[model samples]
Target: MPASSHHYRRTVLLLWLAAAVLLGLTWWHVFALVSQSRAKELANAERDLANLTRVSQEHANRTFRGADQVIRFIQSRYLELGNTLDLKALTLQGVIDAEIFPQVGVIDAMGIYTLSNQPITGKLDLSDREHFKVHVTSTSDALFVSQPVLGRATGKWSIQLTRRINRPNGDFAGVVVVSVDPGYFTRFYKELRLGQRGMMALYGLDGVARALNVGSREEFGRQANNSPVFARIAAGEEEGHYTARSVVDNVDQMVHFRKLPGYSLMIAAGLDTQSVLGNHNAAKEALWLQAAIVSMLVLALATALTRHLRQIGTEMNTRQRAQRQIEERNAQLNAIFDLSPDGFVSFDNKKRVNYISPAFRQMTGMGNETLEGVDENDFSIWLAWRCATSTPFLGVAALRADLAGGKPDPRVLIELNQRGKRVLQLGLRSSKSSSVSQILYLRDVTHEAEVDQMKSEFLATAAHELRTPMASILGYAEVLLNEEFNAATQHEFLNTIYVQSKLMANILNELLDLARIEARRDRDFRYTRVDLQMLVTDLAHTYPVPAGRSGLELTLPEQPLYLMADSGKLRQTLLNVISNAFKYSPHGDPVELKAWIKSTPNRAPGVCIEITDHGIGMSPAQLARVGERFYRADTSGKIPGTGLGMSIVKEIVALHHGTIEIDSAPGLGTTVRLCLPTYATLQDSVDQDGPSRSKLDHAIQDTRPAALS
Candidate 1:
């Protein structure tokens, strides 16, 4: 009986030891996982802060750079035109972005506020201002960024960006000052949606804040020399991040900062530590709860080991089921990866390709190639070869080197010369799983790139078109301001200014009209039955026939050709077509305007208005791009036209459920056919498909105007 008791005591002792060991190991695992998760969370927050800092730095740089450009331009103009620079006219002409720099002025050598975009009520002395004093003391051509101060001219808080104006003889003439609104930066930061406790700031290297936002509170001109960032900057670091207590609010934050290139300013973004780690704390709590439950289970198992040794079998079965569930979950994840539109690739811990999703294979056009087990170097080379030859992957070596150093840019853009031209945004990230060390994601961004490119081109074209007339107006006005002339000469100059002003107004009006039409489509149109014959006759009678050009030869069908359209818009379209006809033709060339009823198979009956012009006809290439905005065949600048008339005409015609066809050849006459749905046919369509459907069909059909040579 004693021996039995000893053995039982030994068994219990052994069970207790096993339970203690299990509990200890389980808790260790939980702590380790929690620590790792905390580190990852902090790391991700730092990365996000870094990205935001970079963006903010870029924004600040652009703002300062643009301000510098404006200052330099004004400085040059002030020196060239002296006091006759006319800042008000420049502002009106959009040479100055008035909304951004509300007060742009010139302070003369004697400290007098000589000129400004804003009206100067009386002589204002600006010599005592830091921006003015700095330029007055030094002849440095570098742009000076000053601390936030109340502008005497603007009557508001602004940052003064100044440049020295030098005369032709190298004398300091004055300072050109541009007042930038500090609220601009803060307004943009608000859009970033940083956490409630987040912060974004712009500080000069000299330790003064240009603009700073902490939570919802904003401060300017606050000294920050005591901040840790200055110490790092003193150590020659251009950019860095760290976790520290804020000097302003005493809140601990994960802060990332970047120094704006070619400027003395730096931008910093911070995420509140508490806010960033809130989720991590929650996860840790759940893990600890799980650990507690596991410990209780271990103790219970130790206590019941003798009576329920069979419980071990049940535990094994449960583990098996759990393993099966894990496998099924993995399969589901695999299916999701397969069906995802974005491409993904995983690299094993050894930096060799382990798996590539089907989408990745198809995206890279390497579906047939065996890529598994390929090392990073070989994979980079293969990928580089697939990229466009014109823009070869020159960064492959650098990217590989960065990866080897365990740091790489998070994102890159690669253009591929594959099935068709494609632009893919590639993102790299570390994987959490033990088997996979890294993950690469690829997303198609061709459409976005194209859109950005088109927008840039449109802005550039519009600017160029507007600048020409502006230059003329500014030049003539400057002449009038700077020099005295005879009555005839003055009248000629005034007339030139008037003509250029009219041209600018015309361009602006047309641009607004085009924008309105594109945005609202036909929603703003007041539709009604309109007489096409009457519209044509009225247009020809009131049309301003250019010098050496005859009136339009108008013809109409016996029956009044009617259209279900906006009469005003229809009249504008006809006028634009007729104007273009006269503008492009030779002397005495008659613009033939003919109207008749027309019908095509499988289409509604319509009225066709044909306008024929016989001089300087376009080539097939030019004709193909006739309706494109700002596309003028006459690049020699001899022609006086905005090149938007045809575009407007096409838009108006399409809105009226019509089609435009252009037939032309180089050195030959051109015929433009505008076919509009007749009132009856439109009424029938409205009865059958509803007005909206009919409009949709018309829009789809008229998306591209037909051109023939």
Candidate 2:
């Protein structure tokens, strides 16, 4: 659609056309070179065939001329010796050369055969022999060469060459025959080293092979009348060449043949076309295949380049669209940072500020100027002007030492105070995606510090509580041992010692119980369905107290008031609270214990138990630490009890997911209210049931507020 894209596509098209043209030219050159090489190979093959033919012709001419000279000498001797001549004696004188001619004989006018090398014991008939009959019938004086025939005398296959023996009056005398082994010619031709299917043959004019060797086969006495090469020779083709399959061996060959001048014989030498031109054809095909593969690879690379160009153009359009929407996303991110409660600050690998949220600016007096050239040491000072001395890191020096590491721990806790008033805890952690980047978070932890201070005071108060009881026990025992008093006074002294010892035991037991309850890790309080009315009734009747003092006053709801809690722990908590009411109250002072089903604001519907005492009520400062472990309101060494009863009671109540509210005054009495979760809030937490008073829309119900005994 655009000018740049259109021009880009046109350029790609031209490149592809150029590649195709080059490939075509490559193939043309390959074919031209193959054709020229093939022409030279054929010319070389023709030269080899011609040389073989010339060699075979020379061998045949020489062999036959020697045979003719030998035959003439034998004929003259036969004419001289007549019937009285001893052919055996002539052969014995080494005249015949038996290695060349195995059997030499003479056939008489009656067609009887005889051997010159050995004595003929029996008469041998040879009338049917081609050698004998050719001489008898022929009128020419030339020597006749016949096809291979089995000798009646020697009983072996041999080439029979014979000449006529005529009388002085011109009557037929007999035949002088030379029996030559066909192996001589066949073995000589086999050594020509022609290709796998080359044909080397010697044949007579009568269209029959005298000796033949084609590839490794040797044949004798076979007709060659149907051969195209032989037909051409018979038609006066004395020396020529042609490409044709041999009729004898049926192989395609290039043949070079010639006829002997003084004899009716032909020599043919040929080489198979498959052997001579095979390498040429293979080289041509390999060149074509290699060129084709290279061309295809070039085309593929060009096509890939074209596609890559198109993709780049498309990507450019997409990049423009993405740029337009970046502003909108930036606004959304700013709004998110503004609304976040916790402060956030991020820094990159170079310790340079990348992003700073509005909350981070509000927590630290920093602005956009803090974004550049701010390292971890500067960030640490920005984290806090001051840090608690109790923690591992205190100042910017410690923070920078930790930051300069190959790999540092991800999370760090920074404690600081804002304007020397409010405390803040900052969490610094590595970003999840990278180790070289970090995120910082800020939260308030002022209330947590106050709780730690209260815990420290509790440990000091526990030591004082134990020492007071042990001092009283040791003082009374020392007074009785050093002075002699009345028996009644001595018994009173023993009673005081026993009472102080019991107080010490109660403090130790309460401390162990509180520690065990708080040490649990989870909501591990075992809960069961409890009938509140029956539980209070049993406690009122079973509690063992002193005989003359004012005991516990029980006020219970009429209904069941079922709850979910650890029953043993709940009973211990109630017992400890009620016992404290009686212990702090003087004799005849009212100690009332009340139970009811009620719901308070910001709490679920539950059963609440209250214990009231009119004895020495606590001040405001004392009530705040009343439930702290081993803390006491009376610190003047007068109270005869451990200071840990209320602490144990508070822990048991908290484990049941409940609350304890203490209301007290300096001169007035004190009332402790303990509220436990009922079945409505704890049905899934534990197995429990409460009374079904669904329509009692008021807060407190079934309160049984009666006068105490």
Best by lDDT: 1
The TM-scores, one per candidate, come to: 0.46, 0.41
- Candidate closest to the true structure, highest TM-score: 1
Error at 211, model 2, angstroms:
0.6
How does residue 133 of candidate 1 score in lDDT? 86
* Tens-digit lDDT string for candidate 2 (485-526): 999999999999988888877776676666566665225565
Q: Rate the local accuracy (lDDT) of all candidates.
A: 0.79, 0.71
Name model 1 segments beyond 4 Å from true.
1-388, 391-402, 405-407, 410-412, 416-421, 430-438, 596-598, 604-606, 654-657, 678-709
Off by over 4 Å in 2: 92-94, 119-121, 300-709
Residue 86 displacement (Å), model 1: 47
Clashes of 2: 0
